[model samples]
Target chain A: MFPEELKYSKEHEWVKLEGNVATIGISSYAQEELGDVVFVELPKAGQEYKANDEIGVVESVKTVSTLYCPVSGKVTAINDELSTQSALINQDPYGKGWIAKVEMSNPAEVESLLSAKDYQSQLAG
Target chain B: MLKKTALYKNHIDLKAKMVPFAGWEMPVFYPAGIIAEHKAVRSSCGVFDVGHMGLINIKPQTSNIKKAEEFLNKIGTNDVSKLIDFSCQYSVLCNEQGGVVDDVLIYKLIDHYIVVVNASNTDKVLAWLSSHAQDIEIEHLLDMSILAVQGPRSLDVIEELFGEEFGFNVLKRNNFLQVGNILVSRTGYTGEDGFELFIPLEEIEIIWDKVVEMKVQPCGLGARDTLRMEAAYPLYGHEYDEKTTPLDAGYSWAVKFGKGEFIGSKALSKEKEAGPKKRLVGVVLSEKNVPREGFKLFNGGAEPIGEITSGTFSPTLEKPIGLAYINNSCHEKNISVEVRGRRVAGEIVTLPFYKHS
Candidate 1:
């Protein structure tokens, strides 16, 4: 299930924009496909990444997946709890499972992301 | 085209995640997820639909146990003479060049021997055995389906299913008992005490349903892999292939050179004397990084020394553990695995990252 207030990327990342800060995490579909989340490699704070950059890594018991930055910006904060409790991604993908918070370099990039309805359609297709 | 096992519909009904495994469309996990399924097998009871594995029946023309033992000894690496009636022995089939064909379990029935091969290498093992046949009938038991009941409470589940009169309590490890058409062997891939039931294809669904009714968690290939890895068991194509020998895989105990000459005996014997060029070792990463198959291993050197064969996050240990074929020359304490172009520090620990108490 996807949230209506969030913007999604083709790589299955969901972005929540509040002013210039965008909270990013993987969608519920991605977490379900990954099964049990065992390890999450979060990017360091104060690191700059462009939109669509490979920012971090998320590893399930079966395989590893790359976390892509939705909007280009400098990472302001990361969820340190994910270092020990990666399964939060599976438990609550949209809430407590948020991976990183980034200060957006260009707020216009949010328009390029898929809307909740469009993302649902993309998943269906 | 992918093949479907007899329990394919059952897997679908359980809302399992189906994946292609060794030419068969098998369930990788159920809705309970891999970690839950894995933990169930370790702590409680778990049933697995292992019907995809191949079963080959070898019967001597003379029906003599001695002749049958002789025939099996020529095909496998273990000492077939030591196998008693209704007992099973883990053995490896090898090519003449000392390379492994497939690891198998030889179940010696009263007058015949049943060889269980991996699903992927079934055709090849059948062909290999047929070509090497001498005054023996090799029949592939296609109608037979295997179901494994594993974990600490496995015996209780078996007793409840077949009733107390079956004498499941007396069934020793690596031993089997036939009840009607089904053959229940006290052997399993999981490290826990368990049984593998070789049942008729038509009766598998009923037995599976009965096991499920008893609240036994149904496991899939994903949990099976993790369980075996935690037990440090070698899987075909991951630990050993046509290029590797049993000694190379740290299974020299399975290869009995004193049992007389068998396939690859000469080469394996020489390798044992000369010492193996490579040794399979268990690795535990210090960090949370999951080392995957084919990931290169380094010993604080610029060049890669070996590569990972099987790796996963140990649900029991809650750490990343793997089996790697490292060069014997690189005997360094600081072993690191190259994961995504970054070196994660690890140590070569003993085999079996987790052991059931």
Candidate 2:
């Protein structure tokens, strides 16, 4: 399941854009598949990244998954609370688990991301 | 194709995450997750389908118990003659060079003895036993299934289920009792007090359901690994490989050097005097990094001293813990491990990060 207002990436990241700043977090589907989230490595504020850049990491008991930058931007903030309570991603993936906020460098890259419907279709196929 | 245990369909019905482990399609965990299942074993009780474990029976061909005891002593690292009837002891099977073949539990039954071995090493162990067969009759009990009921409350739960006829209260650690056809032993891999039931294949489901009805957590291999590691119990493949000896894996107590002419006794006796080259040690990461197998260990330096054999985020400790084979010379109170190219500080705690009275 995915939210209609958000955009999705093939890597299971969800982006909610508000003007030039877009908040990014892993979708609920991704968190569910990872079992229990134990730790997360977040990109720092002011770090520059290109679209599809390897930016962060999420760890569960049995696996480690990389978090990819959905679109080109400079990171502005990260959810600091995740360092202590990493299970927030499993508990509330759309809200308090938001990984980072980025100031989009190229607005045109937004067109490449799939809508919620397209993402759901991609998962099905 | 992977091997399926007797409880494979039951695991599938529970929607367990089935993974290929030791050539068997076994459940890694259920929906409750590994941490919760691990906690259940620590605080209350949990059940595990250990049907994949190998069971072998050894009895003297001429009905001589002394000959059977002698045969077992020649094949096992521990002195099997020490076992009283209906008692069990942890032992290891070793190669000619004193390297570990597998760690096993030997149960002395009334008329014969049973050796429980790792699932992955069962075939090899059987072949080894056959090669060393003298006057003993070897019976392979692979068709049977084993269920492990573990944790602090396990005895009470088992007593409640089996009722007074089973006499769960009278059973001591490493002792066993036969109720109906099932042989229930007060033995477990997890550090908790528990029982491992040796049952017929047809009876596995009924017993599993009965235990589940008692509200004990149904754990899988994922929690099983974490629980054993937290207790500093060495896994066969991880801590005791074909290249490692029991003395090297922090199990010197399991090896009786003076047990008299065993397969690896001569070589082990020699090594026992000199000590092993590498020693297994427990490492608790100072950072949040989960130490993994094959990761290099350092003592606050760039050069590597050892490698991790088994590691995980301990559910009981709430931190990353690991077992490693560091150079015996470099072992100290404080050390560091290279995790993802960064040297995370770690402390050398004693084996078994947790224990309960």
Which candidate ranks first by DockQ, i.e. highest? 1
- Deviation of model 1 at A108, angstroms: 3.1
- In lDDT terms, which candidate is top? 1
Candidate 1's residue-wise lDDT over B41-111, tens digit each?
99999999998899999998986777778988998999988988899999999998789999999999888
Q: Of the true interface contacts, what fraction does each candidate have? A: 0.79, 0.32
Candidate 1: Cα lDDT at B352 = 83
Screening candidate 1 with a backbone cut-off below 3 angstroms (N, C-alpha, C), the clashing residue pairs are none
lDDT string, candidate 2, A98-124, tens digits:
999999999899999999999999989
Q: Please give, as one word, the docking class of candidate 2.
A: medium
Residues B232-314 of candidate 2 have per-residue lDDT tens digits of 89898889888898889878888887767898888888888888889989999888878889889887666888999998888
- TM-scores across all candidates? 0.96, 0.94
